[model samples]
Target: MAAVDDQTPRAQLTASPDGRVTIPAPLRRAAGIEPGRRLVAYVEDGRVVLEEWEHLLRRVQRRVIAATSGHSGSAADALIADRRAEAAHEDVSADATLAGRGAHGPDPA
Candidate 1:
């Protein structure tokens, strides 16, 4: 449970006849929303949370940093490359083993 902090930003929204709400320009700008941009919405803590995909990714990234204690630096790319190389090597080795076995499969004598 989080304590109530009145410092939270608030805004009023109005829905049209078809239940479509028009987000005020100021709020939309603050949230990085642009014209014709798509928003992702979900229910969290009994409230609707909406934001652009990039913004949501940034929020999750921030949490990851805190959880990892700043250890999630730029090593992801290198790690992925290393794993792919290992998989490719295993594939080549398997193919070579299969070819070698076929040559000595059986002596037809």
Candidate 2:
């Protein structure tokens, strides 16, 4: 018996002893939820939010785009840049090791 805005679609749902709740057909249709549709549920701002998997995916994608909007290039580009940095570090380490060694091998302790 939670209070919701009158303008928003509201339904009284009763959970079974096993904690299963049924979403009414009207609400389901309004939310574009069909039978066997995948759903993601979580609490947002102290309220429970149930979203379709597809909708959640799109929301996340939008967030990612907004976050990286200032940055140039795509995910693949970022990954390539990271890999290049790693390779350069490895090369520098190898060069240092080689410089520390004598022509034959490591110097006697």
Find the 10 residues in a row with the least total lDDT in model 2: 99-108
Stretches off by above 4 angstroms in model 1 are 1-10, 57-109
Q: What is the C-alpha lDDT of each candidate?
A: 0.58, 0.63
Error of 2 at 1 (Å): 18
For model 1, residues 1-109, the per-residue Cα lDDT tens digits are 5675675445888765554566777767766778766455656899866656545555555554455563455788556555655565565455445544543245345
Q: How well does each candidate superpose onto the true structure, as a TM-score? A: 0.40, 0.55
Candidate 2 ranges beyond 4 A from true positions:
1-8, 72-77, 80-109
List of clashing residue pairs for candidate 1: none
lDDT string, candidate 2, 8-58, tens digits: 677899876655568888888877888866665656889666766656556
Worst window of 10 by summed lDDT in candidate 1? 99-108
Per-residue error (Å), model 1, residue 16: 2.4
